[model samples]
Target: MKRHNAGELPLSAPAGDAKRGLGKEEAAEQGKVDRYGKGRVRWSRLCFLFAVVSTACVVARHCYDAGLGRGNSAAVVRIDAVPGPPRKIIPIARGEPSEEPRHRDPPSPPGDDATSSSSGSDEPDDIDDGAGAASSSKQLPSPSKAAAHGHQQAGHPFARALAAADNKADLCGGQYIYVQELPARFNKDIVQYCDKLSPWTDMCRYTANGGFGPLLRGGKAAFQGAGAGWYDTHEHALDVVFHERIKRYECLTEDASLAAAVFVPVYAGLDVARHLWGNNVSARDELALDLANVLAQRPEWRAMGGRDHFFVAGRTTWDFRRKPGAHAGWGSTLLNLPAVNNMTALVVEASPWHLNDIAIPYSTAFHPASDEDLFFWQDRVRALHRRYLFSFAGLPRPGDAKSIEGRLVDQCKASPACSVMECSTTGPDNKCESPAAVMKLFQSSTFCLLPRGSTDTLRAAFDALLAGCIPVFFHPASAYVQYTWHLPKNHVDYSVYIPEEDVRKNASVEETLRKISPEMVTTMRDNVVGLIPSVTYGDATSRIETTVKDAFDIAVAAVIDKVTKLRRGIVEGRAEEEKLEKYSWKYPLLAQGQKAEDHHEWDPLFN
Candidate 1:
């Protein structure tokens, strides 16, 4: 790929041209930038004037072109169009079975370890396996000869074979991964100050186990699986999974120059959460701004304009894109920053329109430690004798009259067979917050109500899938649209969808669920069980032994695939000014017969 100086930004479009054809839905989206009743900001005409002052073509054109919002401000700017061929869509070989590893005889050591970047540094003192496990160089597996080739070995079959191995080697691949050794302030400093980060909840629980949080209290007995060591942790802590997993990633290398993609391990979500509740935009944005400044100074940023770099944000994309003049918003200005705009961002919930933000699975309960545990849980769920036809586990939101969760809660409460576990509790832990309770609720029910939460989707949907219950979503963004790379292409294969408007006006949740034949429900449950491994973000300690790939593996592979393609495009001067967000794990679901209108729009800003 032809490298560009990061300082040399591409020309941008005029800001005034951003709102040429503004629509009602988009205007409303920009107008009331609600942060789920917290830090709600009203961006009116007056604010537009202020936003114009700070408006650069990069931000304006990106928002407008990406369909996030309309730009009404007369922000001065310049635009440029880099010529390229029409993009040729490439099919990704995901979830395809690969042959077993054919281990080769060790190659002779190189004359001089030119790429041995960490040869002088002391080896790891102790490998963190939750328990203090003594790790030595002899115990650690050496990188395969193919991995030493760095970017050159990206899609090699030998790497794929290693990843397919039924042992610890399953996590090993030939593609070299480099985790940036970011300054302490970006990661540990933020965690050390967790107590002061949030006023509503204690941040300690959310930061445990490298951000996957402490494992659920009672899961080993209920769900039989070996190495449940880190399988089931707090569902909201996705930042931890990415941070720790890459440390043990099979392809990880110490040499940055010998890496296919560079991972910046900054806990952006936890950093911004400290200021989400208060109306202090600068305070909320402090860490992110600092991060951008630090990253910009790095040689890697200049080498590829941040294109070959990536990071994981445990929160939604909206949480990091605080508009210029907005009075309040839940997040910082991380995504909107010029430096970050070029990088691949793996977020739990991504803006459907944002090109660089890839949607990943929200951390959920029932994280299996190994393939044995995964299959055992799947078998139990498949054979579960569900007593209830449906279930809903949430508290009614009294504020929003048209709240989907409120409506679902009411419907479930009224139904004779539906189980309801109202989330009305306080303190560190409660039955409502327990994974056991949540799992039991779904296990006893045939169908689980998965309405839109603060965001388009919630972590509970995966929990339901783990318990062998089929999820019924009101919004397409809730699951079908968001997890295109992780879930199956056909929605009907594992889930049921009833539009919110239809359910609010005429349809009965119970009646709709009952209408489905028992056989179909059984089939859906089986499908859901089969998909558990793909969506579940397992404990970092567990080796992904299942033939089925989990969320973390799929996401990492996708990023590498994307970065490789992007570099190839740049090198050939055929880079398309578009994204592969619409691509799916299999066939595009929309093209498979579902009506476009069925995909109801939802707010990415809410959570």
Candidate 2:
């Protein structure tokens, strides 16, 4: 082999041969380089594919663990298969708990600490669960929707949670109330024609100042302390008064879901009062029927079927429980309605036989503005020097010749120790109409006689308590059965009960009362003074500054407690088994067996 440059052909060869030899050698070297380069490129591509697949697997695993892959296995695979650049994954913050499904009771909105302002539109928006998962397209179900859906929305988790939270922090101890926004015809329209509400007197004045009537004047000197709380309140103004008081209720919630009880402000008493004197049964019943139908259609009413629903009747239960086919009956058949039978009625006088009827005190002249004022009045009454041993203040009931009112009045007039303020049937001489004169007489007496009025109960008993006068009852129905919630359980603690029969048989009222020792009388008077707050309605114009429960407070609490128990009983399926009618007249006081009719042959009286 001759020595030569790298690309040079050997000597003594043909030019074509050398050229061809160089070409072949160069081609062979290029082939080796191309093969090696192609192999390296393929290996690099294989490594990149492996890395991408491994990264996708890790991401899919994470998505599955995070609950995003639930019910979608294809989604996990699709994450890697999508024709897009790789996405950057951000890790969750350290120490943060993983997102999980949780169920909690919902809470109501914050209550109005002061006066309740309008809650805006009647229909509220559906509350969210705070998870940001609710679709914007969803809306609160309408009443019709709720009806068709069987009140499914009432059981919504979000609403339940809100209610639970509000209940926990409620000043009313889980007793939240919801007032329905009814048509004006149901309440306000009737109130507008206050003068026409009563067939006799002009009720417009009494309806003023939130149904507390006019501010009482000329008698402030008689009241203790500043005497700023007294009002010339009418006896039948409880419906308006209660409505006004509830409007300022501290625990009022706009959301119905959170309500422990629902209030249907129908002004049932006023409605019935308008048609009471007339014989038009249709006129009396039409509005009540309409109210029943309206309430029955509500979602709130559907929740408990009116069992947890209540309203102020402002009159005796008899005023609303007119017998069917008695076209000339005394009042509208409101209480007898199928819809009303299930609901609770707070009245001035409750029926002894009806479980749904609850007795609340009639509106008295004294409405204490604050706890201090109440205490002052209590002390003032306690310190008074009573002049008369006993007193009577009322007109004789007409047409009831069997009534013992005549004998009692005669006995009172004959006794030098008794002060009698006789009321004329029709004239300015009707001392019973004057709150000032009546309270004065009651205040001056050691004991006040409480005989049966149009019904078995009388507002005078409460007036006597307000005046720190021990009540002398001729019948148990006058106070014991009617005011079980307001009065002490033992009748002897605050009142004297002499059988009506004994009084009719010429028993001496003065001699019987004089027999009670002075010390015992003092003790009873002290008890009567102590019960003033519970029997007296507070001024609705402002909130009570102290914790002392007034008549309004006591009634509302009892109603709330009752409704709560009723709802619980319904939920536990025991409400149907508890027969309220089977119990006795003293059901609330004695539980059973003791009867109002058993004493003084009172069976025919209720019938």
Candidate of highest TM-score: 2
lDDT of 1 by residue, 180-226 (tens): 66899898887898787677777787677766666654555455443
For every candidate structure, what is the RMSD over all alpha carbons to the true structure, in angstroms? 30.1, 12.8
Model 1 lDDT, full chain set: 0.65
Candidate 2 on 1-607: residue-level lDDT in tens?
A: 8788867965576756756766777867967897999999999999999999999999978987766777754544334542221111111222343132233322212331101222344444342122211112223333342233222223332234123322222233345577887999988899898889876788899988888889877665466444477777888988899998888776665545556677888898988899888878889999988988888766566445677688998988888888766677678888888778888889998877778888889999888777878888888899999889999987666578657787778888898888988888655678788777888899899999988866788778888899899999987778787877888888898899888888878889888998999999999988888898899888756664568888888887887777665444433335344545634355566436655334434444444
Residue 144's lDDT in candidate 1: 51
Judging by lDDT against the true structure, name the best candidate.
2
TM-score per candidate:
0.67, 0.74
The CA root-mean-square deviation of candidate 2, after full C-alpha superposition on the true structure, stands at 12.8
In candidate 2, residue 132 scores what lDDT? 13
Q: Which 10 residues in a row give candidate 2 its minimum summed lDDT?
A: 85-94
The local lDDT score (0 to 100) that residue 399 gets in candidate 2 is 76
Per-residue error for 189 in candidate 2, Å, reads 1.6
Error of 1 at 342 (Å): 0.9
